[model samples]
Target: MRVLVVEDETSLAEVVRRGLTREGFVVDVMHDGQDGLWAATESAYDVIVLDIMLPGLDGYQVIARLREAGVWTPVLMLTAVDGEHDQAEAFNLGADDYLTKPFSFVVLVARLRALIRRGAPERPVVLTNGSLSLDPVRRRVLRHGSEIALTPKEFALLTFLMMHAGEVVTKATILDAVWDPAYDGDVNIVEVYVGYLRRKIDTPFAEASIETVRGVGYRLLEAGPAGPAGPAGPAEPAEPAEPA
Candidate 1:
């Protein structure tokens, strides 16, 4: 496995490099936050060992900036201070693992291996599209950071559309994916619920995001200059959600 180590302390960085090399890893060390961030972005490493304290930008900023740019490489944070708030901040800023100073190299190796095993960027948090975001686990939806209320059926329908965002999903497709086989309602019911969804998600925004394909179906178009929202969801963060 290849690893990127960002540590300002030269001795500590070398020790980490030697230890990780002993553990079957190809290691590269960067002592500045700017250099580390550049290396993290330019190099393809299986995992990153980042120190929270560095020049130019801190570890938290490095992680956040990388994530904002869609570089989802796994980050294992290495720091000297130990505090509950620090740990929470690391996670909030997208650190996968945290370790205090004076740590065991063995435990470090073990955590690095575990982090690498989990593989790609699989965050526990739900996502947002356009001005809309939903957490199915919590049955909640948010628009532009403000929570938007949705009824059970409305939530189901919106979820279906957002899942197929940018696509011209027909009423029949909505019925099959959202409603139960036992449902005996008119397929026109899809239009009713689509209206319900618009009341909260789209109408609140300046430009209407959802569009109708005369006599065909409906699609959620992004309000940007780059064509419609496309099947990708929203502007850029149209996160690829799994099959519901």
Candidate 2:
């Protein structure tokens, strides 16, 4: 295993380096946060042992920047502050594991092992097309970075379209996916919600993200310049269905 230790305490850092090396691990030591962050990003290490207090960027900043840059290497924070808030902040900023100062070498090694075994959890990605963004897990929608309120059904319908952006989705297909299988209500509900989505997600912004294909269905335009809203004269008509 390869490890990078970012503690500034010379004696403590040396002890950890020697100990990990004796355990058959390749170790790289950095005495400050700037160098630590640079090395962590520039090198591929199995795990990182980070100290919260250090010169230049702190542990929180280093990890935050790393994550912002989409680097997912596992990180274990080593810090003297054991306060609950500090720990919470570390986690909120994306530290994989946190160990307070005065920690035992054996315990540290074990924690590192556990983190490696668990691996990095896949980060959820917010779906985006143009100014619109949807976080399915958080159930949040943003347009141009501003939150847009959506009813549950509206959210479901919009999500379906966004998921299949750029494709001609039939009204029947949408009804089957977004509404209950047993739904025997008006099929025009799909049109109504599409209108609602356009009003909120497109109209005010002068975007025609949802395009109607008269006698067919609709499509959520892929991100970029959009043409006027209305029927995209039949190229491939959606499989015929009872009029919505």
Candidate 3:
């Protein structure tokens, strides 16, 4: 497989190149962000190993530009800084995988192979269900062309639901995804947040985009519910029915 390694550290870059070459991969190395971005955009690569700290544009900008240019090559971001926010930013910018500094060469190879196996598929910058749209990078939600304010928890719940649009996600699953998996609080919190989302994203627009699945869970409709535009009236009961 052909791979591009974009790292400012010349010594490390050569080491990675030699190791990968030994692993039967055809490797190309770029020492700075500008050169890396140009190589990535101008050539077809099975995958890319990019460093976050670069002299010219930086890793984040490189990945963002690569994606904007419609290059869907899977990218495995390498960075010395390890933080959740940094990881989230990389993912938002279309990075396929991430590895922090001091990582094992074995892990790197395995992750690269896994990414290559997955291949590159275009990922939408904005997620939408009907008139409702969610921009993960900007942390914005809009309904019917107007922006809607949402609390952090409410936003997380909405994001989870929208990501699984048209699927019934159970309370347990939602809790694990949106809330702390170690959370011991009442599971009904999911119902409350779902209600909150409906009020902001659906009720105001006279839409029923989120559907209760009775004993199952909830499904976000792919298209807005058909009806005349008007007040949505009362919010749905926040209590979910017991599974039958």
Candidate 1 per-residue lDDT, tens place, 32-145, comes to 887887788677898999999998778987786565434567898988899999999999877889999989999999999998998756443565565567775466787667
lDDT of 3 by residue, 94-144 (tens): 999999998899999999999999988745568777677877656689877
Best by lDDT: 3
Per-model lDDT: 0.75, 0.78, 0.81
**On residues 82-163, what C-alpha lDDT tens digit does candidate 2 reach at each position?**
9999999998988889998899989998998887787765554777777788776567898777899887677777777777
Better of 2 and 3 by TM-score: 2
* RMSD list, candidates in order: 16.3, 17.4, 13.9
Collision count for each candidate, in order: 1, 0, 0
Candidate 2 ranges with C-alpha deviation above 4 Å: 126-244
- Pairs that collide in candidate 3 are none
> What's the CA error at residue 73 for candidate 1, in Å?
1.3
Q: Comparing candidate 2 with candidate 3, which one achieves the higher lDDT? A: 3
Instruction: List TM-scores for all candidates, in order.
Output: 0.54, 0.54, 0.52
